[model samples]
Target: MSRTTRPRKGAAHGDSRPAQAARPSPPTAETVTPDGPRYLYGIVRDTAPLDVGRIGLGIVPAQVYAVSEAGLAALVSVAPGRVVDPTRAHLLGHQRVTETLLREHTVIPVAFGTVMASEAQVRALLRTAQGELSGVLDALEGKVELGLKVLWHREHLAQRLVLEDAQLLRRDDEPEAEHERRLEAAVEDRAGRDMRALLEGLRPRAAAMREHPPVGERMLLNAAFLVERPRLEPFEEKVRSLAARSDTYTFRFTGPWAPYSFVDVHLGLRDEDASLP
Candidate 1:
C-alpha cells in the first residue's frame, strides 16, 4: 500500500511535508477517524420537537439529537468507533439516556451500543424498517414494561417448602446422607410447583409477558410484563399481593418504563463498513 501526502492548510502548492514528527497511532482496533459511526438510542415519534441535551458516548462531546427519514425518527449521537466499548461508563450512559426518554415519550428502546456508519445509514434503517417501526410505535403507545426478579433465600425457602408439602419428603429409595447433603434440591422440587402457581396468578394481569433465564443460583423468576398505562395501578396491586404471599423470598421489581421487551423490530446491522473485510 502507498500513502499519499496532502498539503496542510495555507502551505505552498508543492510543500506537503510537515515541520514536525508524525503522530503515533492508537492501539489496534480503534476507529481512527472523527466520523466513524453514530450510536442509536431508540426511536421516538417525530411529530414533536425533541429537547434532548448533549449527553452521549464518544471521546468528543456529543449532543443528543434526532434524525428522521420516511416518517421515522431515531435518537442518536456521535460514536468514536464502529462499536462503543461495553464498559460500565458506556453501558450506564446509554441506559440513563433511555431512562430520561421514558419520562415524556414512548420510546422503542434500541439495544445498547447500536451504531450506524453515518446519518445516511440511520436514514436507510428507518426506511427499511418503516412500516414495522410505525406499527410498533402504535401498539406500544400508552403501554410500558415492568421487570420482576424473584429470589429465594435458598436455605429458608427450601425448608419452608419442604415443611408445607409432605410430597417433598425425602424418598425411601434415596440415601439419607445424600438427601441431607442436597436438601436444597429436594426443597426446590416442591418450590417449582409454587412458582408455577405464581406464574399463572400473574399472567392475567399482563398484556404480554417475557420470561428470562435466571442469572444466579438463588434467582427463581426473571420476567418482564408489558402493561397498559390504565392498568398500572392494578398491576402494582397484583405484584404486592404476590409479594405478600412469599415470606421467604425477595423480589426486585422495576419499571412502568418504555415497552422495551414488547417491540418486535430488529436492526441487526453488525457493521457499517461492510466492504472492510
Candidate 2:
C-alpha cells in the first residue's frame, strides 16, 4: 500500500525517546509574537522532534514541525490566525501533512481546522491525553487505510438478469410498470449479495473496516479498510481478484492513506470565538 518505509520494530508504537527535554525550547517573549496560533496536523507516539517540511497552509506556506510532550509529538505549524479557513488549498495542505506522516508513522489525525493558542496548549493537550493517545496509537501501529467503491450499469444488469432468469422475464399479462418494480427489487437483492461477498473476501486481511453510504443508485459499495503494512500487497491482490471476477460491476480502488476513519478520539476544544463558516 505504501512505498514509504516502515519504522523500526517498537518504534511505531513507542520508543525510549526522552519527552519534553528533547524538544526545542519555547521562544523567549522578545523573539515570539503575541498571537501566533498553532495549526495541528496529527499526533504520533514517542518520536524525536522532526521538521516535516514547508507544506502548511497560509498566505505563505509555513514550515511544519513536531512539539513533544510525555513521549508523544504533535505535528503543527504557526497559523496566520486563530481560525484557519477550510479552503481547498488549506484542506489539501492538511491532508498532505497527514499522508506524509503516514508514510512512517501511525497518525491519530486531528479534526480539520484545529488551532491552539500556543505551544503550551498543544503540549498541554498531549500531556493530558497521553494514556488515551498512546492506546490508540498502539492499536493503529503499522496500519494504513484504503478505500473501495463498486458501481454497476443498472439497465445493463437488469436486462441481463431478465434474459437469464425465467422469473424475471416480463409477462404479457403483467403491466410494464409492475414488471419494472420487480426488476428493481431483484437488482437491489443481487447488489447486496455481491457487496457482502466482496467484503467477506477481504475482511480477514483488515484490522478494521468501515462502510460509508453509497452516493448514487448505481453505487453498491463504498468502504474503507484498515490494513497492516505487511498485509497491504495481499489485500490489494484480493481486491484485484474480486474485480476480475465481476464484469457486470465497475470497481474503483484508492489509497494507502492516513487512517482518517479509524481514529475515534475527540479533543473537546471550544472554538466559540472564531468566525468559522
Candidate 3:
C-alpha cells in the first residue's frame, strides 16, 4: 500500500531560510531583562502611537510602540526578560498587532518572537534598511496578501475524473487487481488537472502571487496572492464562488494579511547593518 501523510500546517516550509530585510534575533531568556529587550512585530510607515493594551509576550504586560527612522518604523514592545514561546497566545498576539496595522497601513511583517535588545537597536535597523524597506513598502502599498490552500480527496477526485472522462480508469470494477503505484500516480495526475481549473479562477484578480511547494500529498495548491485593496472583495468573492463550485476538493482561504510570503526580509546571525544592542 502506498500511504500518504500531511505535515503540520506551515512546518514543511521552514522559516529559517534567507529572507530580504535584516532583523534582530529573538531575545534569549538567560540574557534578557525587563524593559531591556524590545519584541518586534513588523515594520511600517510613520503612524500614530498604537495602544491595544497588554497583549505582549511573557508573564507581564508590555506596551507596543514604533521606533521610527527616516519615515520607517519597527513596531515593538518592551519584553519581560524571557524568550517568547510559540504558544497559541503569543502567536495570536503577534498576528493581532500586525492585523491592526493592516487596517490603515501596508507593513512588512517580521516573524513571531523577533526581538531587539533595546529600542535604539531597532531604530538603527530602520535607518539602515530605510532605502530598501521603503521601496518594498511602496510596492506593497494599497495591497494585502491572501492565502489559499487546496486539499483534494484522492478517491473523490478520481471518481470525479472518471465521470469527466470515463476513460480515466481502464477498468472501473477491478479494485482487487489495482496496483498501489498506479493508484498514487493516477491521483497525482488528477490533482494537476484540478489545480489548473482552480488557478484559472483566481489569477486574474491577484496583482501578484507566491506559490509555496505543496506541504504533502493531499495538498494540491498552497499559495499566497498579493492583491490590490480595491480587488480584495472580488478576490474573496471568487474564492467563495469556487468553493461553492466544488466538493471533490476543499478550499482553505485566509487573509488580507501582511505579505509574509511575498516580503523579502532576511536578518542573519550577524547582519552587520543590524548592529544595535
The 0-to-1 C-alpha lDDT of every candidate, in the order given, reads 0.67, 0.76, 0.68
Which of the two, 2 or 3, has more TM-score? 2
Worst 10 residues of 3 by lDDT: 1-10
- What would the per-residue lDDT of candidate 3 be over residues 1-277, giving only the tens digit for each residue? 1111211222211111223343333443422444477788888766444445555554444556656566666777775443677877677778778776776677788877676777767777777677777778778877778889988778887677667875556665666446445656777876787788888878888988888999997888898899987777677778888888778888888776778888876543354323221
Candidate 1: TM-score? Answer: 0.76
User: How big is the RMSD of model 2?
Assistant: 4.0
Expressed as tens digits, the lDDT of each residue in 1-277 for candidate 2 is 1233333444343443445444653343311556458888888875654657788775456678787778888888887677778888888888789877876677888778878888777877877778888888888878888888888998888887887898998888999999989999998888788889899988999999999999988788889999988887788888888888868998888887778878878665455221111
Among these predicted structures, which one has the highest lDDT?
2
- Superposition error at 230 for model 2 (Å): 0.6
**Candidate 2, residue 96: lDDT:** 80
Candidate 1, residues 134-201, lDDT tens digits: the string is 77777776567888888877778767767877766789898888777668677666578877888788
For model 2, the stretches where C-alpha displacement exceeds 4 angstroms are 1-22, 25-31, 269-277
Ranking by lDDT: 2, 3, 1
* Positional deviation of residue 51's Cα in model 3 after best superposition, in angstroms: 3.9
lDDT score at residue 134, model 2, on the 0-100 scale: 83
